[model samples]
Target chain A: MSLASRELPSVAATMAPPRSPADTPAGAISGPSWLNNLRAMLAKELLLEWRNLSRLGSVALFGAVTLVLFSFVAPPQAGARRMATAGFLVLALLLSSTLSLSESFRKETHHRALTGLLLVPVAPSAIFIAKAFANFFQLVLLAPVLIPVALVLFSVDLTATSGVSYPLLQLLAVWALASAGLAAPGTLYAAMTSDLRGRDVVLPLLFFPLVVPVLLAAVKATALVLSGDAMGQLGSWNLLLLIFAVVHGTLGTVLFGYAVEES
Target chain B: MRGKFQWEHAVLLLALVLLTVGTYIGLAVAPPERHMGDVQRIMYVHVPTAWIAMLSLTVAFVAAIGSLWSGKHKWDAAVVGSTETGVVLTGLLLSQGMIWARATWGVWWDWDVRLTTSLVMFILFAGVLALRASVDSAERRASWSAVAIIVAYADVPLVYFCVRWWRSLHQVQSTPETVDAAMMLPLRINAFGMLFLATWFIVRRARLELAQRQVEETTLPERRSVEEVQHA
Candidate 1:
């Protein structure tokens, strides 16, 4: 047997027992019960974030600062200014999401928690799915504050036939969909780079290019919502976003097992 | 070893001959276009470079799948070789495209579908190479890069479709029907020349990767023992 496989039992012995009975097989958890492991992992991630609100706060602060700075730098012209604001909003979210993803993976590396997780009998894909969901949640949490600030600063006309509530709901949908699209590849790339030094530099270089489609669709959709597209052009962009989310999410889950096993 | 050297030399000689003839045909034999005159000649190089760029990446994608399926060092070498070649060709394609655009479109750059998709492809593969460089272990690097290439390749069609649907200022994509028969000759010649050159480069680079891996294996035998002991 390979050294890694030989060492697995000892590592498993050192790790805590599975929290749920379903996760623990009669003897040694032979094959992971994916759904149960996913639930347990996702809970652990959420609980960890709840315990440490500072990290989420910092990410939100960074996004807010970016939006404010963008609003100032953008030309005060009416038409161009609104379009630029949509672009910048996507940019800010992209940057903040990159930071949060790297940080989330960094936490595991910092506390050596990854080793413990790796030791668990659950499939590595479970860890990936859980981390992706957690990152998506964190990005969603930023929407309430970030969206309002963006709308106000960019002078987005929300008083359409349906009023502010409709646009707000549209924007939130964009955020959630974009967040899923971003987080899948973001979490996977974070795990890939977690062991490397200078991962801060490496992650964005790897990430931004891969996620360009997501950024483009999100920005376009957001612009349409801001301008109030009456012709239903937004549907195509939303479809693109959905395709991006599904493609990356599925790819990340399937590939994460291979990526995380590297160390 | 002797056979390999003979094939390499033969391929090199053939590539040189084809390239010289292709350049002559492209620059001299082919009549200038009605719209742009001699500046349109750049298409001979630009189109082939773009074609080969996509071709090389397609090769890399296949090699990535091969590496994942067979877990062979040779497949990883093929991945590296084709990917690196794709990057160089992509860079060439971009510059030639800019030159062609400046003469024809009156702008050095346009956010057109093809240009945007090609740029994204270049960045994506370049990131794969960068990722390959950062990792320490051969096995890890190979496997991770294989996975990366597959993921990046998945985006190729998506990027193409997205950009195409979003905006297109560039000409409608050229096909045999659009290209003049006389103009098609040089384009075909240059394309074959490029294909031969790309093949030689990929073969040579793959061999180099294999040789380097061999040397690394011999020189770093102790690292394995150390890892084994650590795991133990």
Candidate 2:
């Protein structure tokens, strides 16, 4: 909308500026081309994340260490073991998502780095989608590395008996949905907060609440899956995940443009 | 123009009087429910406070949208002020809910969907306010807080729907058909009265806050001049 220039044109005459020269890309901006753009943006986002290797490494290490510590505290019973597996899985997802999503817009805001990105031919929605995708991928990648350690520490069997296949998929779905929910608004707020004093504190303050629904759903669904409850229940969890993802994705896309412009 | 009371102020005062009378009527005059007993009286306050909480969040969302669309500091301030009021009202409602629960449900808390969602809403409100306080720059704080407000608020209905969609211990809505004539009058009156009170609070606080900021802006140059003279 900002790309449109006004000359007292009629409403019908007013049109948004095209990011791609092709008219086809204009419509595709909502579909596959956006997906491709999202993938590329995600790749760039991942590279940006990898640049902060120390932070990422510490977070992963902290997650593993936390699981190891929790194992000792949990009651040494079969039911407790069942509970521990879910708890550790949730712990890993929470650690990775919160840590990464909290910093989702860090690179963009540092030294007005985001302004340079905005000058590129990318759409604002694309930027959000890309950031969300990258964060989700990173959380996923970070999770598997902890899974084996968590299983050993929590005494979980990752076999067919574990029945984690459906749950794992469900958990992954929740994680991706939760990451998008967090990162979408988070990236925008981080950009705004980073420009203010004491960003060290403000970032988390802005992020935690915006993602509570995601956190609640993710925690519940993941816990259910890890507990290997009735398969029938997964349908409901998946529905919740779908609703969360769609709502966040739509809200994020529509509003990211405003945040970027204001930032 | 500035010295005289406006019609809006008169309306607010009338609403306050009505609220006081309504509370007296609710607590003193209304017949107690056979099931909930005297504790049911709390519904007059509890239900209204919960309504205000919901209203506050909605206003915050609207303010965020206004700020984003118009880029006004006043809109941002209203959003922040409404959010604070919402958080306080939510805390009150939660306490009242707990008291009512003890009298009615035997347990102080049940983790019911509605109650849990309300708790989550308060957490979101508190977090946003904390973020607003920690940031030093007015412009950056306003912009960022507005973004958070909008995003969080947009999820509110989803949360409500999610709770409603699930089977939970929390009782669903009590329709007009279900409610007796005695409870309906106070419920309706207090609901409107709370809206009036909430609007007055948000407007008055927003104006006072804006005036204070303007005072600071106007004084900055004078303060700078004093410092220069002292150095000289």
Candidate 3:
């Protein structure tokens, strides 16, 4: 079924004459079908991103340029350069993620699409989850391009150095977990600021301070992995990253309904 | 209302008196530390400011919960007042810390757990105030800020833990056991003085906010009616 037809009953109940017996059953039935509504919303988000591929391309380009600038500013010593690679890479991802988040929510506000989404009968948390997943997916796609460019530009030796191994698997794991940490809060803040003036300026002000733990843990984990101490030194930082992800993800999901309500 | 003002005035006066006595004790009565000498006097202000900063933010956090639970504007005012006070204290703490660090650690800044967490807390609550300012509607601002404060406060422990586990170049937390008894007088006095001053600030600011909100509530409908008459 088309998305509009599926949402019509809920929208109709909200707009139509009050509490007729005929509409009451439809409203009650629709409230319990939030799972299907969530799936449809998630699909719509992905489809939207796929159709507008340029957004993804621009984010990738932004990350690439940031990486280049960082490399130039970095120390020239091979040892020092290797040590700084992970930090620079995470910084690039963070700056690019901020831009993407601002753009995503600005579009929603410009088109008044967020209000329409809120009008759907689905739980508001579903909208948050879907948007977070869309952001996480975009970051995942950018990681391949950004990581390789960073590794080459910084002259990082990813091969096992001394007693530790710097495997590709560990690097990807850290990237994914860190991206999840960033995306959950990023999407929530994007929603919170989208309706306000100077939202672009406000997002970073509110976002960076809150995400310090994430950046700290991610940079630490990436550093450990790159230095070939992945298993030994990474355990606690990994746990911290997991906690950061879970706390933010759960908070964003629960509070998002309240955040976006009556906006 | 007159009685309330009297109590507030009394508290402010007591804080001022204690502050004067505390500075005297901190400068003259307390003996200098053997290691750092007189430069350690900065601790009299620094420690109290740090304590009050954290205490004020904790107050704001509780007020946030109350605002969300009761949906009362008074709680919102409390949050705003305490949060603004906390931000000011945090700024003072950072400045005091920089001076102390310069004397003790020989550096203006260090990435130690306490120092980093203080910086993070300052930025987070300042952001809260900024978020409060950006929104137009009072009700919307209150609810959104309540949620934001809760989220930011929740991250405090995590920031502390991350910084602690990563590495610490600064000394471990100071407790009564570590501090000499002779040094404790000024520290205790200043702590109480800072507490009273912070409470006075919060109470006065909260009253101002509530009065402003009341004015808006009273005038908004009249303004709307005037607009309606114009349209008619």
lDDT of 2 at B158: 69
Best by TM-score: 1
Give the per-residue lDDT digits (tens) of candidate 2, residues B82-188: 88889888988888878877767788986666776787788877878887777544565676678778777877776766655554445663322456777767877
Candidate with maximal lDDT: 3
lDDT of 3 at A14: 46
On residues B77-178, what C-alpha lDDT tens digit does candidate 1 reach at each position?
999999999999998888887877776778899787888888999999999899988877898888889988998999888888877766644567432345
Could you give candidate 2's per-residue lDDT for residues A1-263 as a string of tens digits? Answer: 11111211221121234456763443245775565556555656665555556666777787787777778787889778766576566656665656666565654554444554455435678777776666666666666667677767776654434445655566566656655655555655655565555776766665665555565566666666666655556567657766777777787777776666633
How big is the positional error of residue B215 in model 3, measured in Å on the Cα after superposition?
2.7
Q: What shift in Å separates residue A154 of candidate 1 from its native position after superposition?
A: 2.1
| Ordering by TM-score | 1, 3, 2
User: For model 2, what TM-score does chain A reach?
Assistant: 0.72
Tell me the deviation in Å of residue A244 in model 3.
Answer: 0.3
Candidate 3 lDDT over A1-263, as tens digits, reads: 13433443443334323244544322222353455456666876786677657778989999999999999999999899999998999999899999888866766664355666666444677778888998888888888899999999998767855445546778888888888888988898899898787788788999999989989899988888888673587877888888998999898987887788763
- For candidate 2, the iRMS in Å is 2.8
Clashing pairs in 1: none
**Top model number, DockQ:** 3
Error of 1 at B133 (Å): 1.4
How large is the interface RMSD of each prediction?
A: 1.4, 2.8, 1.2
- Ranked by TM-score, the better of candidates 1 and 3 is 1
Cand 1, B chain, TM: 0.91
